[model samples]
Target: MDIDGADKQEEKPVKKAKVAAAQASASAESAAPYPDMALAQDIHRLTMIHAGKLSVDDATSITGTKPEDLLERVMLRVGAGSSKPFDDVIKENEEKYKAIEKEEGKDVSKVEAKEKEEQVDDSEEPLLNPELYRHLQSTLAYNSSSALSEDQLKTLAAHNESILAILAEGVTKAKEEAGDMEVLHATMEIARYQAKTGTKESALAAYENVLALPKLSVGKKLDGHLEMARVCSFWGDWRQMKDVLEKAQKIIASGGDWDRRNRLKAYQSLSNILVREFEPASKLLLGGIATFSCTELCEYPEYIMYAIITNLLFLKRTELKKNIIDGSEVLQVAKEIPVVLKLANTLYECDYKAYLHTIVDLQPHLVANRYLQPHSGYILRELHVLAFQQFLDSYQSVTLDSMAASFGVGTEFLDMQLSRFIAAGRLTAKIDKYGGVVETNRPDWKNARYQEMIQKGDLLLNRIQKLGRVVDL
Candidate 1:
């Protein structure tokens, strides 16, 4: 059985996407870059840079106002890996900033315009959410600029400062008055602003307060949790992200709107995958495939990749064929990355050897993903286990060499791998070393209790029925 598994990560295929992602929001005039999206883009490029698909120089060009910061982080040190020392770049940027400050000193025209902008009308329109601030900021910035520069940074810094003041004033004013609309919008502004522009700790803290507000609406409360969940995910705060997501799930349980429910699925699926919880992740990704509108965390095409990865890991052939092979949403992005469909078909077609190599090809992409990097080994290992088990289910007994041939691995290597997994209870087949054969002892007892892991023309179920008859006598 040879499975030609598809490589999930290909920076070249997504190169234009990455450049667009980085460039689309690459302006000093734009509202401050949403911190999570910015971090994700950098991580995407960093993995590409490390994997040789993207050069370090290209990465620098593709990243933020501080190319040195990303390069330094990429090399694990800005100065050590490249010819240029990081400290020098840091010094240069500082000096450049000081010179800009001196130039801005006499620039009263910009300041005067900014001052008027900050003097907000203090209207707490019931529907005027603080999240709209990010939407307005992102919209304004996207329309105005491309490529961040020192001047852009200065402008953005001042922009954040001005906006933060307005949001802070709104929050304080709402606190003094304590009306439902005023409190919800005011708190959301602080939470949403911090999520987009401030640190994770501050964002999480602000969100905590939002969720604590008695006057917060159900929809607004769920929004707060989801935003915090995204912030936690971007910062690699999985533990907190899990709690926040679970809380979101609870809120949605009491009847969230369609959009909110789907966004929760997208957010939870991403979090579950990062934390190595594949089962629930698979369900969420597969269920929310059609209604995936949560691009704030990731693009739809990228979301499809996650659905493919998780479902391929756990879905049985019948389930795989129905949900993925026949899935319209998964097929829609088929041309964008054929490998995702290729990988799924390889597994479904029972091409074990091809699937193994496909995983090998995908290793770089999996390892490069910021969210998937930590569990790269675990996911691959589980895929292999699924493949090996799928292979064994077709056999009552097979020689070690034959099984090895089925998977394109050496007999010795297969034996070693099988032994470890069998011992770990990952595989149900047992290796008979002296006989040079592996025998599967498929237990209907457990399968009936959980996964009915049977394939077409397999005797596992008949054997279970016979055993049940014997017990009845």
Candidate 2:
């Protein structure tokens, strides 16, 4: 029965599997470039036949192949393989030929030859007239090593704007070729002189021209951007100021080693824009703080501080004459505030004492409604003292451990407080000499209060030590 069934099945159907391998192999070979260089050349030749540069008959005659096959190969190489489109490639070749003719001065017609020779002689003469030369010399001499006199700069700036730009460019080029640092120094002096004498527009134009020079490096570009941003900020052109800062940030982010001072200045300019414009200040600040926390770049602290101070000042302004506080909103703001302050204090010239004083003064009022805590007040006191001590004693630099010890708490507790300082731009953290471990400092301690506190803390610590020694004896 089984044998009979098998025979019936065989008679009923015979199956065959269809493989697509042969078709795919053919398709791949068609897509690939010719393996032989001679074949590639033949293809390229055929493509050039209709390219208008070569006659189709000549192309076929040279390659000893049909115009169609030559065209196909050329299209495959230029259009689809190793060559460009036939028309474009031919046009480029034609342009090159014309350029060679132009370089050899073969394009000069008989009538124009005599005129061209005369023109060449005219071009050899210096463009600067006697009077202009005298003025240029006097200006260069006066502004050589020092800042230009206000009157002289004003006089020069009063001339055509393009003249100032040309002069600046010339100076930049000469200095660059001469490898003289003093050139930039002199240029800045001239710019300052112009700015001070009411030729700010010309001065900026001159600086802009200098910045636009190709020889200027990334560092120089940043300097120019920073200077422009500063001028714009002074003019209350916040938008342009922001734009320049953003450009500087991009340059720096792309591995440009801008001077530290310029980086900080750029950040300050951006922060000022945020504060003044009130456009996305909070988000920018928060993002900047987060970036600093992650990257630990030099400018991160500056950004974090800028955000913290701007936000705190904003909040402080709002808090005045307000009794009802939204807990969720306040907490959300508060949480980020510490983070910003912590980063700020670690790296910037933070006004820790002022920030602490502000926090302390406001804490009592805030605590009444359970907005802050007693511990928060204590942390402020400790921060103030610790920062003060650091400011007083050169060796006693403020750090999380020192701050924590002052409050009899762990580093974690101090870290929380430090976060607020970082957010506020009063403090910053860095990898210490020990490596991998963090250290902290207050960047904005320039105020007299911080100095005063430092002195007072020194006196108080001394007295306590003396009393303890007496009691032991």
Candidate 3:
């Protein structure tokens, strides 16, 4: 009896260890990327089992399945194999639904009579809940497809709208049935589609709705705030962007994980950019660039060039050198994103023409990046001023035509640009439009020196008079 008890005690520890391991594994998997193949397979298998879409034996035999394999099996079972598309599936379901409608129309009274007769059959249950079945099938169809084309996008958008309508028909019931996370995820997905398809207003509304949901998780709220910030960025709404970012940062500070670090850093970088806080932006970008994983770096490579550009703009070369350029990672990243090196070199050499050409070449890419897009106009203006200042340093007086030719622009354009600078009190020079020359009118150092001495004498005289009065002299 003692031997058996000892064996049971040992088994208890083993069981506890297994339970702990399983829990740890589950937590790790939950934090993994959505597209992780292994995690997808696990979710697929569990979903199939829970929905009774697979038999017990089949479920037992479904170990070590790949995502593609699961997708193929589900497609084949639904009469949608490699040759079939999502549109065909939708059309097929629509046809079946139409046929059911016709049958119900002809047999309405008969169905009512049959239902009355079978009222005593209390144990009877629906073979399939139509709503759940439809939801499942639509999800499967969506997951089984490859990248969506424009036509697919239109179809999907309509489908999502209908789903939203259905959910809206009973908001309380939908929340109870789908849970807050699922609803929030659906809303975010729809908002993203709207944003991508040029329905910015609708997207913004949907994102705001996500924030309004009660009992929403911090993670989902943060995501909604971040997405709204992106929308604000698209419109160059810096104040709204700042507000959304502040909310997102608060959520993260409350206990968001490292998995969200890259996104947080990216948003902070952008917020700094919009406010023209280049020094903090540069530091944030460099810190993220240094600490982010290879996968993260690949996912958010825009940080590299933005960092280099910000440092160059602020002339924080010493800090940039100490924190970034002097490091080996900058060189490695430069190899991955060559624009970093190009911008750095252009800034160092003060090559206005080359810099302008580089900026023009990279305009499309800059406009696409969420962090950089909102600030592109400001960045371009700063570049133009820097380029003009560099060109001005080379000559005391240059003809507008010569300057235009050097900058590869027309005289009128150059005149307009220089005029803007002059008006802004930035250039410290004037344009001699009649003479067709731009002349440097920097303050004369000797006269400025004499004026500084006179001011100092006046200040000293005032101080002496005050002191003499205090001393009763």
Best by lDDT: 1
Steric clash count of candidate 3: 0
Off by over 4 Å in 1: 1-33, 44-163, 170-183, 212-214, 444-473
Tens-place lDDT digits, model 3, residues 325-432: 665656655554565567666755666567778777555444434345445677778768877876787789999998888777889989999999889987878898
| Per-prediction TM-score to the true structure, in the order listed | 0.65, 0.27, 0.47
Better of 2 and 3 by TM-score: 3
Q: Which order, best to worst by TM-score?
A: 1, 3, 2
Q: Which stretches of candidate 2 lie over 4 Å from their true place?
A: 1-177, 180-186, 258-309, 313-473
Q: Which ten residues in a row have the lowest lDDT in candidate 2?
A: 3-12
Give per-residue lDDT, candidate 2, residue 122: 26
* Clash count list over all predictions: 11, 36, 0
RMSD of 3: 19.8
Model 1 residue 399 CA deviation in Å = 2.2
TM-score result, candidate 3: 0.47
The all-Cα superposition gives candidate 2 an RMSD in Å to the true structure of: 31.1
User: Over all chains combined, what TM-score does candidate 1 have?
Assistant: 0.65
Candidate 3: 10-residue stretch with minimal lDDT: 3-12
Candidate 1 per-residue lDDT over residues 87-128, each given as its tens digit: 443344345333333323233445334533642311110111
